[model samples]
Target: MGEVKDVPLLSELLKDSPKNWGKWGADDEVGSLNYLTSLEVIRGVGMVRSGKVFTLQVPMGAPEGDPIWPGRRTAQRVNVMDHSHYQCGKGPHFPGELHYADDMMIMYLQGSTQYDALGHVWYDDQIYNGFEAETTTGGMTKASVLPIAEKGVVGRGVLIDMARYRLKNVLDRGETFDHEDLMAAAAQQGVEIKKHDILIIRTGFIGSFYTMPSDNFYDNFVEPGLTYSPELVSWFKDMEIPNLVTDTIANEVTIDPVSGIALPLHSALMRNLGVAFTEITILDELADDCAADGQWAFLYVAAPLKVVGGSGAPVNPVVIK
Candidate 1:
């Protein structure tokens, strides 16, 4: 088989795709998140009926290890100081005989449930808002996650459980879905995907990662996700979706089957339409509750850590029904 570098470039695949560059302004780093105004927050609040809550972050340092992108490792937490240290007379002792435990984590910013910076992906030597890609050198001077973390994401969220809709516990590897499929799943759940809604899709992919053997899960790893197409790109533009949260590592298929390009939607949507992307989320609990209550819409609130110059930041998104 031919190598990945032989495929068409992302710029070529998304050549005519719609772009929201300078839509908010040249200085805007948060991109489509600007759609989440107070009015949208009010709209989100209206969806809270029973007041059940769900937190959508996967445990970092899980015993089974995290399901991360191939080249990256799971988060590793180390105890800087603990009871063991105190017992060994190695830990600092505060006045009044106070003792405390401390810890630190080593991880890729995108290792867990996280929000990707607008500058996370790009092509043609440019990032979102037409910022020169060179600005990303040394540490995201243009569209880092800091701006997004400060603004925050709060709005209506709709869950489209594609696995349940397709009568599968988990989608087959490389399975693909598109905008029409999303609408169909929403229709099945009796919900409408409105403008500025935080679109959260559950493929049951992450849930499988915990049960299946790690080697099997990573072998020929192609995640089932939204495929790239001009029409699908247009739909995202028309819908004005602020954020896309999914149970997969990459928000879309790892490699576009048709174009043989990797993550074309990252360019067509995030880098062009300026939509926010949240990946590696724990959505089974949220999806189960939504399925049980027949209520798919809810208030989605997330604040990624304000890591300056970070390409992305971990987030524990909260969903209120």
Candidate 2:
């Protein structure tokens, strides 16, 4: 209801991050609050508590197969140019200089398992829930996605290892995970559904998306367990979970018969219902930790890049044990 502003803002102080340096062109690297000025700031979003959470990358770094989508934008090697400061003299901005960096791998990130930002989807040109398509662009990072306070996703998380559920045993990489398989996985794990809970699906497709046929461009039919039926999407959107994450590239896959293309659930959830989604992330690292400790609920965190109207982001989420 207010307005996004670009007043003299305190610039960001860098800490030698190989990726994304150009924060105000180096002249403000003293970690001083001065550069914070003139940085185009917005703080409508409440203080993020996920500051203490964990992350599981699914569509991260072009996991395995052909990570491109309808646009055919092939995933380039993750390359970040300079990161240090390029001090060009001094000024009231204390540590003054241009904080610059090229070759920066910038991806608009979402919160947990890394779902699509509210700006990522829309139906017939309109954004999610009650957003207008024409007016949803170029927002400040802090104000990019829905405010952490408004629709912040802090809820119970359940993992359904569809592959294991279907095979009736632990699965190896590249195993097929279908809808029927997901149910079995839930039954085996004794996991139940509840309101406001985030669902983390494991199809064991992580490795494949990263190995073997490296350029396995997402095709509709014949793709293994990496996909699901359109009904699954409809069901999830209807269930109205806060969000749905996964240990795979995309949640539901290219079901030629189901949705007639790749990314079925994406359209169903994002375009239709505005359900946040995450791509590839690192989740299995804590699988045993979670199972051993019987910990399903975690203080999840997803701090995506504030790419201002960007599609998605690369995140380093941490889950507090």
Candidate 3:
């Protein structure tokens, strides 16, 4: 696409989009996640059959470095104390001569595979649940990741492997898909995406990031993902989806080809409908297994770190089959 100024504003594009604000109550922070009631938890647990488990987080500080959004740096792990300190006789002393290494990591809250708080993005000066955008000025005070972390996300997760469905190892950059494509992929996998299902879509985008040249991966800076449409947004609301997990930087196409707008779904579905977003997940292993066994539905469980007043939090979603 061209410069962002050439595109329609998100507020204009999503002005007619549906919203679930105040549906859960005025004090609500987590939006569509409210759909994951106890019954939804039980429905997720019932998807477990083979006892196989998959962790959907990529390495945080890999040798090749973690993948992050543009303009954000990779995680930097610093060793505050190590055996070298003891060797140099400058380490802290203990009564029993105990030795230990301590370290800390500096990274964006959304740098790793993570869940975005409902208040992470907004237009019109309002976030999910009508929280004022100013509430996120210094750090999120309302609708922060803390609330979502405390609530937790547990539900049946249905995997829709769009790459496999389309007979490709990975979709082309800037490519877009929608709810109709998702339904078609689910049908191809012989699974039904039910209400309150934690929808996980795989385009093989994030997986390819590791092997391809970083420059090439980010050259055009657009990601292949679901695009914005009123019908797509309505489908999410009508289906009562609780969360959307994907192996991409952003869950939606970076820029809408039609309106020339950028990540309009961030405004339509997340900011408006209050649907949670899980991004940059590692789904190759899970996608491979699902393709092999033809089992696409599973119990999905994830608990983001309880970072008080955070816009987003890192997470390692667990999937059980």
Candidate 4:
């Protein structure tokens, strides 16, 4: 429903206008933070203003590995035992040992490279934007992401069903996704993206993970895959998106048709800019509802384990309409 502008002409965007040698300067415009979004591709149209919060979490099973999109691993059945218990018959076989069975896992939170709350990941031994790392710890032990309590999370949420649009020949899922794709989807549904809004995408890849857990788990090449371009990243960063989420196993597209690498979105967002990502959500029900209601956006909330100094934490996000 929106206009296409020749794949955003990465060469130009990298330059300035993203085509004709940029706008006014730098031939090497690697990161200037200019942004643009059109409401042409409307998604989560109705849910954006919903009163209740939406849920976006999937049930946990045994730890599983995605043959495709390997940016993050999955929870599957595993042998867990708390070392503190009488394993070999002792006063204390092991302290802080495993207890919960495969029944629950702490893998979905910040999504793999999980988030280390302001209490975690410190810059120059400092936490968050300016909190000193020493202040977070007792006796100068210096805390990491572990101490992150539940209060650290709680915010508004929005979702875009990019996958659904493609199926109706509305959004282009066959081609690489760019910033405009988001706009186009929004416009088609008559929705607008606002500031500080957490954007979620449903790429249709969630099916295999849901319907055929065994096959989707083992097969490397499957349909409903999702991906994002650097242009999209620029837009989100410029928009200052606090959190990003997806219904698929991997937040980013698995295969890089151009570079043949895995997780271009994840690499660019995480290792590159440190944007928070959420994955493995049970969006099928939501997707179905979105299709029927023609609304995509919804209020979302997810709380992940406050693991310390860890790469990621496990979370169960909920989206409400």
Error of 2 at 313 (Å): 2.4
Question: Model 3, range 229-286, lDDT digits (tens) per residue?
Answer: 8999999999999899999989989888899887888888888999999999999999
TM-score for all models, in order of appearance: 0.98, 0.57, 0.98, 0.59
lDDT of 3: 0.92
lDDT of 1 by residue, 272-315 (tens): 98899999998888888888889999999999999999999999
lDDT of each: 0.92, 0.45, 0.92, 0.49
lDDT of the structure predicted as candidate 4: 0.49
Give one digit per residue, the lDDT tens place, for model 2 in 239-301. 555556676555555343332343444544554444566665555655656556555445444
Considering summed lDDT, which 10 consecutive residues are worst modelled in model 2?
8-17
Listed per candidate, the RMSD to the true structure in angstroms reads: 1.2, 15.6, 1.1, 10.4
RMSD over all Cα atoms, model 3: 1.1
Clashing pairs in 1: none
Question: Over the stretch 156-273, how does candidate 4's per-residue lDDT look in tens digits?
Answer: 4556778666774222223456568877887887777776567777665544454466554445443334455556767766776656676654565555555455455554553234
Q: Which of the two, 2 or 4, has more lDDT?
A: 4
lDDT of 2 at 183: 58
